[model samples]
Target: MTTDSLILPIALPLLGALLATALPRIAPLLGVLTAALTAMSGLWLTGLVWVSGDLSIVLGGWGLPLGIGLSADGLSAALLAMSSLVGLGISVYALGYFSGSERGLHFWPLWLLLWTALNGVFLAADLFNLYVMLELLGLSAAALGALTGSRDAVSANLRYLLVGLLGSITYLLGVALIYTAYGTLDIGLLSERVEPSALVSTSLVLMTAGLALKAALFPLHFWLPPAHANAPAPVSAALSALVVKAAFYLILRLWTDLFATITDAGAAFILGALGAGAILWGSWRALRAERLKLLAAYSTVAQIGYLFLFFPLLQALPPGPARDDLFAACVLMAVTHGFAKAGFFLAAGLVQKKAGHDRIDELGGAAQSMPATTFSIALAGSALIGLPPSGSFIAKWVLMQSALETGQWWWLIVIALGTLLAAAYIFRVLSRAFGQEPTPQCFITDARAEIPALLLALASVALLGLAAGPIWSLLGFEGVQI
Candidate 1:
């Protein structure tokens, strides 16, 4: 049953993609149904993990060295759940977003394929399998990013494709080196068999660099803003919310599990330093961005910085409740940003659709004309800003607590500065709503499009924030020192 649950999320979306490609007329409905089923399967698996334990399955009963494996630990399960839920919302929004257009047919299939790759990445237990999934994800995402048919969209995604291929090639080479040394690609087997050596360090650097490029961490993020900002709204949401995190997830998986014995404070601190640069640089750029989507895109760079900041703290703390809290907090922050960014991009899409442009200064009328959309922005912004009662607020709290506890108070200053910048930029958009403009005649301009944004934002604030206790439990941590 556990294996069935794990496979269903990936399989269903692949099936849906084929179905959508074969039956274009019913693509929208098919996408919604497929995404909903996938979400249900992921949620069920998460529940099973929470109630039971982590699951591992080898394909075709060929266990271990000869077979491909899929495993869902608490970490993978949480991410898989986030991907499915966000995907379902995006699918619904795209139905109205594409609305009887020829592009809708293309959108459904690519989006479903992307969803499949996302699930596959989270569940993949071997390095080689993860590489395959990441390539599929990159191709599908790049294709979807170019769906707008604008020259900017096409050019940006073309660059994105080339960069993704480069990153994948580097990552595959690292995998090859490791496999040659260890005679295996299974993450579990490698973790047990591997030892610290020059070969291992080289492989780590190569792999981490490749994954970091994909995660859009700091200087490597050059291709992200344009690719994300110019994509269709639903595509933008998925790209920002789900796609980049997949790479980061693999990085975290390797750093914490497979390479733990070989990793050290110095290496973790170096990554954290890059994260600090990302926070400062990305936030400054976001504040200066004239366009709404670009601001959101830059903000993704900053939020990703926060995820990397966890490493130093994790390294400084010894294994215990404190360490567990920091680890779980990282997952919490990633998932919170997932929901919040998805909502922000979806709401930004609506504003762009109605106003015909997304210039932040010119958005007064569009922001005011749709109260629900405005509210969605506000809610998501609060999460981004780490305002109270949002999941990000809780995550940030835990992060700061860990930092202070470890005597690394320097990170507190970084978090504080990022928080202030987040508030300023977020409210910069909300201030547009206060300007003189005719109010919305109805609370919803389009329920199909607006509701998903509202729901995702609300989840980030209320559902995730108030109920985060379950997250620790879901992650299989027993201590609650935080």
Candidate 2:
């Protein structure tokens, strides 16, 4: 009893992964085809979710407790589509990205596997199943991150893998607690059964800590910069854009439904405070970083900080127009940032390739030389800075309004300051790129490399001025005014 709707997006790549593995040499070509098919199906399935409320598939003809299941609500499908789009872009960019290597063959399979895990986790309505997928994702990502063959890459990935294991174990501990307390791991049923108890509260705290670290929340974000900064470009893009986000999406679901009415207000505030700190600290590092990739990595640290800031706001609002506005705003922030940040990272990859290094101060006169790539980076940076006509702008506006509605003026202040800091760091790079160098490097052309970067960047910017009607619709929340 597979929901034909849910089956295609998840199943196809899985089968493709097997095929690509069997062929070995067709890894690159097959990876692209697989990701492209997944993206298209992701888009189509999202449409099905919108037209119908939610789509679900039960495995092996057993229902509920005895069987596994996948479900797509508005939120799940939107993320699926985003993952597909970003995954496809990563695949295309990787064609020029990994090029020729004994290592490249291994990269394609692991990457597609990562994408499958991401989409699976989002659609998973089963708890233990999600845990299994999480483990798969962590292992694949760590393997991919270590692919560069550089000592630093291996070292950073080792640390990353260690941190990731701790987080997963913590999350698993929470699941064990829930199963012990409630006797079921089905999310929908658990939502109905979840109740406040000493065990429930303890489990909540444990899960929160684990997911926070995985999401690279401040104080626990120590592993992110090193891993991301040291990883290769395509891997870094996937890690930053999609991998870190998987955990955050889990946190959102936990807080929104499972924690229903049992919100630990004090804990929510603590996360918010740390999120703000991450914004400041990460932005400061980005402003100071001598290397392009490190700058982008730190920017991810800052951007992800913004993602967690919504937890407190969602907890504070009453579930009505106020809460819905907060939800929409947060969703907008996540999707918008996903695209923009990925674009920024990909564009940075091209810049590093052309300049032979990514030192900001040394990048004088790049604007005249690599206008397509540079402009795309600058445009993607605009979304990160919350400029108007961008989805981030609209999202931030709604978030600010939510703050005002709740009299959370301090939250308002923090948002404003974060915007200014983001602008400062983003402009630092742009300004350095445009500086008048006595001798601009006559860089060789690689349209194959630059085109994908520009297309992704343009998509990020287009998200601002244009409507997200299709994307939002696919998520089943179109015209979903609160």
Candidate 3:
């Protein structure tokens, strides 16, 4: 039942993409239907995992060496659930968003394809298939980023495309090396067979670098801000909230599973150092950003740094309840940021549309006009700032606790500084909401668009944080360790 449920999330979106391209006029209806069905299927799979634990299936009944396999563990199920809910919200928002534009027709097909890719990445059990999913995801994302057709959007996304190609090539080379070494690409098989060698180490480096580029880690993130900022709001939301997470998921999977025996303190610390750089650099840039979307884009860089900061601490501890708690915390942070960032981008889009610009200073009046949008920003900003009761707050607390417990006190300093920087930039935007402007006739403008943004924002702080205990149980952990 769980394996059957997994196929629907991937298949429904592919069908929607074809239907949307063939029937552009009714694309919005098709998109909503796709989102509803896909989201339901994802939820069903998550429930099955909760009840039955990990599930795997090999396509065509050709088990092992010749078959494509799909698997859903607690981690995959959690991400799938986050993507489905957020995807559904974005689809509804897009319905009101693209109503009168030619780009609207282009959006549904490309977006659904992107959705298909996200699902594929989460459920794929083979390394080579993950590479295929990454390629499709990259192509669709680059195309979507260019939907605005502005000079900046086109040029930025072209660079994004080139970078994505380089990443894919590097990742594919690593996959080839792995297959040549072990004669198979199954992740579970690799975990049992992998042994430390120069070739294996080099392949690990190649795969990590490729995924880092895709995930926009630190120095490799040059293409992110421009591409994310210039895209349509829904596109921006999807890119930051869903697409990058897929790449990072692979990196985490490889490190924890296939390369676990080979991981060392030096390598983990190096990764954490890069994360520190991203935190300081990305936050400083976001503080100085003049435009709202660009600020949000830079914040994504900083938020990703927080995710990576979990690595060194994870490596420092032995496998136990403490380590498991940190692992679950990192996933919770990623999921929380998914919902928060999506809401932020959607609200930013509305602000840009109404005010005709997203300049932070000029947005004072625009921010104050729509109560719902402002409220959405406030909720999301709370999460971004790691304020109490937000999932990030809980995640960061666990992360810092681990850092301290492991005697790696330096990371705590990094977290503190990053938290301060996050607070500064988040409050910078929120402050504008108090500026004088004519009162809005209602808390919302188009309920279709604003409500989705509001609901997602609310979930980030409320549903994910206060109720996140189940994340451990869903991930198959013994109990809430923290």
lDDT of 1 by residue, 329-446 (tens): 9999999999999999999999999889998887775555899999999999999999889988989999999997999989988998898788879988888766665334355799
Q: Give TM per candidate.
A: 0.90, 0.89, 0.90
The CA lDDT of each predicted structure is: 0.92, 0.84, 0.91
Segments in model 2 whose C-alpha atoms lie over 4 Å from true places: 438-482
Off by over 4 Å in 1: 437-482
Which stretches in model 3 have alpha-carbon errors above 4 Å? Answer: 437-482
Q: How accurate locally is residue 359 in candidate 3, as Cα lDDT from 0 to 100?
A: 82
**Residue by residue across 218-322, what tens digits does model 2's lDDT show?**
989988888987777888889998998899889888889777757777888888889889988888888778887888888888888887778788888878988
Cα error, candidate 2, residue 352 (Å): 1.0
lDDT, candidate 3, 1-482, per-residue tens: 55777688888999999999999999888988988998998889999999999998888788688898999999999999999999999999999999988889999999999999999999999999999999999999999999999999999999999999999899999999988899999999999999998888889989999999999999999999999999999999999999999988998898888899887889888889988989989999999998999999999999998888888888999999999999999999999999999999999999898888888876666554888998898899999989999999999999988987999988877887788788889887877656774334344779999999999997896578656888888999876544
RMSD of each: 9.6, 9.8, 9.7
Clashing pairs in 2: 389-464, 390-464
Looking at model 2, residue 170 earns an lDDT score of 97
